[model samples]
Target: QRLLVTIALEAARVMEEGIVTDPREADVGSILAFGFAPYTGGALSYIDGIGAKLFVKIAKGLQKKYGAEFKAPKLLLDMAEKGETFYERFDPY
Candidate 1:
């Protein structure tokens, strides 16, 4: 679960950095190219499934245990604060 949160935070960072233009593309590509957990529907979808608020909370715990690498991106923090979801915010359509 914590690892998944980390993955979500990284995915969020990539999106925040404009490395990936769309959330669905990032999600599908990760699944097909990197074999990122298909059950959770890739990183962004997993965060959406878990909800940003909870994911951030988990990420915070992991960050405390692990290090700065677990830090949540500004995009994710903003999303959690606004109660936003990846698909809703980064609509692929």
Candidate 2:
């Protein structure tokens, strides 16, 4: 479960910051391209459910264990600092 969350959130961070512009697209790609489990509500939702600040902290810990690949991007850190979820911060409309 931890691995699943980590990979999913990391992919979300990647997409949110660069690969994709909208949260919906990111979530859709995770579901369509990777067949991610829908119960978690996609990767960004998983992080949002965990709280962005907590997610960053968890990602930092994961980065310690898994090297820099698990590092959260600056955008995530900023959003976390503001207590904003991905949907709230980057809503697709």
Candidate 3:
């Protein structure tokens, strides 16, 4: 679970930094290139499935226990605060 949170948040951070514009591209790249957990449907999808608000809470706990590396990205925090999901916000469809 912690690992999942880390992956999701890190991916979110990458996006937040403008390293990737399309969430779908990032998701597909991670799955195809890095062999990320396919069952979770890639990192962003996993976060979306988990719900941004809940994922932020989990990430905050992990961040407190772990370190700044586990800190939730500003994009994710904003999403959580706005009650937005990746799919709903990015809307690949």
Clashes per candidate, residues 3 or more apart or on different chains: 0, 0, 0
TM-score of 2: 0.81
Ranking by lDDT: 1, 3, 2
Q: Compared with the true structure, what per-residue lDDT tens digits does model 1 show for residues 1-93?
A: 765676677789989999998998889877787678899889899999989999889888888998999899999999999999999998888
Candidates 1 and 3 compared by TM-score, better number: 1
**lDDT comparison, 1 vs 3, better candidate:** 1
Indicate the residue-level lDDT of 22 in model 1: 96
What lDDT is reached at residue 7 by model 2? 63
What is each predicted model's overall lDDT from 0 to 1? Answer: 0.87, 0.76, 0.83
Runs of candidate 2 exceeding 4 Å displacement: 15-18
Predicted candidate 3 versus true structure: per-residue lDDT over 1-93, tens digit per residue: 877776777789888888887889878877887677998889898888888889888888988988888888789989999999877787778
TM-score of the candidate numbered 3? 0.89
Model 3 Cα RMSD, 1 decimal: 1.4
Residue-level lDDT of model 2, residues 1-93, one tens digit each, is: 556555666666676557777777777777677777788777777778888898888888888877887778878888789999878877776
Which residue runs of candidate 1 sit more than 4 Å off their true CA positions? Answer: none
TM per model? 0.91, 0.81, 0.89
Candidate 2 overall lDDT versus native: 0.76
